[model samples]
Target chain A: MIEVREDWCKGCNLCIERCPIDALEESDVLNRRGIRPPRLKKENECNYCRLCELICPDLAITVISDDPDEEEKKPVKKTLLTPVGGKIK
Target chain B: MVEIKTADELNKKFLREGMWPTIFCNGCGHGVVLEYTFWALEELGLDMDKVIFASGIGCSSRLPGYINADGLHTTHGRAIAFATGIKAADPDFHIIVFTGDGDCAGIGGNHFIHAARRNIDMTVIMINNFIYGMTGGQLAPTAPLGSVATTAPYGNIEHPFDICDLACALGANYVARWGVSHPYQPIKSIKEGLQKKGFSLLEFLAPCPTAYGRRNKLGDIKKHWAWYDDNTILIEDYEKIMTYGSEEEKEQVKDKIQLGVFQDIQKPGFFESYEKLVDRLKEKEAKTKEGKK
Candidate 1:
């Protein structure tokens, strides 16, 4: 699972536009007085394509998953938390 | 890393606050002009107090506002006029103008030609990014024929002005062309021009990544660099030409315009002659007054 630092996000939508899996849908809930946070509604169907992080202007979001479906792609060394020092632990 | 300094970081006396331009894209050509100007000034090592930076409207003109030196960011095409005034006001000061194709050739055409004709004692750095990178990349006086600009969607049919040839013919004492690709040459040229006595012009061919690069299919700054290597022919190494102007020099050059030092002749600068005329006037006034008394 990926955590979004809502306080830092300016809602640039660079991540929302580049997400290929369509797992991230923007939530209506506004944070810090009122900017909508990009909510992870379809986290179960994530592929962990890190294009969102590369395109984000504010460095707000990151995608993570344990199964790592995109293994054949570049070995993305993202610091995603895993279960008690388990795979990424 | 001594983090690359932004325009705001430069707190020199010449550049003014709230005037540093935020126009150029990341890794744009304007940076090269700024860096070169700084390098030239560092080489001159003049008293910082006696230096004036004049500029017209364009991305390049914004350079005058970035440095920590005395600056005058005048109206478009008026950099030369503004610089001329500064030079005339204080002949000891080193006056430099940083301008663009549109600012110098488009709006400031009359000032450009006349200043050169008068052989004004100043140094001009014309950053020719083909089209006007600012104000949305419109076609300019120096845009090469067939090159695509915002206004010239299809292609530019009009001929471009070769600044070196034009300035040389207009009585400018020194004129040279060097692109950002060969930044060192322009840097050296600027240093030399600052030391020289008469009007000197250095035309720098820079890449406009946002406007010209995108529209002309240049895609990235690297692609524009490649374009320079492929399209430009360096006039040095005189033997590289097919036909030289003369039979003897033809055997030497074959046929080509040499790049280094196109022209460096002893032309009388306006300031020197004007000062002499003033002295004559004062002398005549003294004689007349004495005779009347």
Candidate 2:
């Protein structure tokens, strides 16, 4: 899941500007509630690659980890290296 | 001087099974900083549950994984911003943000200043490896001028940010810097950062064996650590290091920008202010409802 705090976003587009995969696209339309708010166009296309998370200037993103789903996130060494940088897999 | 212990003993007793992170290269400074962090956490008897690690991207961002905690790998340059949320949610939790020089000072700069302005209860362990180790070693905002990097093979023209000064200028409650090889100061400053009630930014001039390695001829981690021995000056010796006449002067001026708690001022923290805002909002809502009736 790619969670974003849109209001906290300054629309600097650093995340959009710095995203490598082009997975993040600027919304053609403005958000219903705000002015010039940035929106994530392709949520499913997000590879959980951490690239977006690696570029957000406001720390507004929270990309759920792969292999370790939200259920299995309870402080255990279940496995490694599917998505994040470790190669233990 | 604090009694420095053996690494073998420290590693065996303090480090968890997964603490030796794989994200960093063999001689990367992240590993050394992580080692030191764990040592500090252990020595201070920090509650793992009450401790949380936050970070922005770049090589140093890998710190959250090594330490077992309620970790947050936030967006680039926003570790401190995300940490502000976590710390605001529960002020008791010891929030620590790890970020690279570029991640903190370049892309995430505004967030850094705002977080400091608000004096959020958190510690940002900034690793100034001179060059950006991640993303193919670019010249970061903190990269020393004339330093060679992937982006500036001919030599960088950019002047680096003296991070301690930056932190100080921003009204950060506590500010200090240390070299990774400075034996005990990183841990000491970190401990103080953890204990302090408001924003504390600990800038560590860590030697990046990977990024800085191929350039400066400091080939290995050991050699880099050795170099720190010659360059790092403690804060206590600040006045003494200033008398050097030339750029070729010894690391004698290390005292001006070295290990030790530089600032520990007590001021109103972020949560304290946030709660007041929340209370005001709640009160305004209640008043509006009453007026409607």
Candidate 3:
């Protein structure tokens, strides 16, 4: 599954232009930034190659793999170490 | 083992608090480059505790502040010099410099050349956005010849500096140029540069749609990015064409920028040689003490 953070998206359309299969297209819906962010228009044609995720200049795209076998690979979210708090695990 | 993480996860792990929603304009390539660097760091399973991000004044140089790691926001054109001090003080620290073309090639050209010549162990990820994006679109040293900028109202008459070529000529350990259009190659190259024991220069030709693009009539962000794809040629293909290709083919790529690994050589870094010299002198001193005894 491909998820896009709409708030972070700057409507660059780089992912749409760089997609090998043209699976992504600009959505008519306007984001808060008044820019048209891209959405996955052709799911079947999408290869999940993660090219859009890689090329998005805004870091707005995230490709979540749907493979059942890969379910155990969830990563623990890390917290930032505050200046005086020392290291946080 | 480091799991295969998504872009969101990478950001959560690497990006600092309150730094989200970066200051970069729409269609800026700096965030893409930052993502690639994060991917490289994850693949290598590096400890951020030991990594140091150094930068000078520019839009690209603003990158280090967003990373959740130790960083130095130094004076204009002095990122390399400050990074050198950090490396010398503690050679174990992995130093990565994020500098813009103006900061690296224009103001810091002297430091850049000497660092590459000495083969200092640091990774330099220079984002050449053509114009100085931060300072009202001034003509940068890496700006293409005849490119229009605020300073160059008509057209720039100065020849652009080839950063990767300069590094290769200085015999830097690793040197490569890639546009932000290509993601995989830059990730691989950034990883290689990080792992290499000496100076590595990975120059990225990125688009500045707001600053450079607006002034040069490349206002449309998509077309500005497509321009990179159209203007650059892979170094391997370039070599093949120059050798056996017809005149027409050769002429087509004459104005194109060559992108690929320009140099990769194994050589002892400056610190390594200096350590050896110290060891040799210490051995001589011990021998003299034994003779006196």
**lDDT: which candidate is best?**
3
Interface RMSD of predicted model 1: 18.3
lDDT string for model 3 (A23-71, tens) is 7888889989899888878554556768789988778899876775654
A1-89 per-residue lDDT for model 2 (tens digits): 55665544444454454344445666665544453544556544444555444333233455654455543423322221121111111
Instruction: Give a tens-digit lDDT track for model 1, residues A1-89.
Output: 56676765555453554455655677788989377767677534455555454334333455545554554344433433111111100
How many collisions between residues are there in candidate 3? 0
Q: How well is candidate 3 docked (DockQ)?
A: 0.25
Q: What TM-score does candidate 1 reach?
A: 0.68
Model 1 residue B195 CA deviation in Å: 1.0
Off by over 4 Å in 2: A1-89, B1-21, B241-259, B276-293
Off by over 4 Å in 1: A1-89, B1-22, B238-240, B244-259, B290-293
Per-residue accuracy of model 2 over B29-131 as CA lDDT, tens digit each: 5655776677677778777788888888888887677555678998888888788778767788988898888999898999988888888888888888888
Per-candidate TM-score against the hidden true structure? 0.68, 0.65, 0.92
For this target, which candidate reaches the highest TM-score against the unseen true structure? 3
lDDT, residue B92, candidate 2:
82
Candidate 3: stretches off by over 4 Å: A42-44, A67-89
lDDT value, residue A63 of candidate 2: 64
Supply the TM-score for candidate 3: 0.92
Q: In the order shown, what is each candidate's alpha-carbon RMSD?
A: 13.8, 18.3, 8.8
TM-score of predicted structure 3, chain A: 0.69
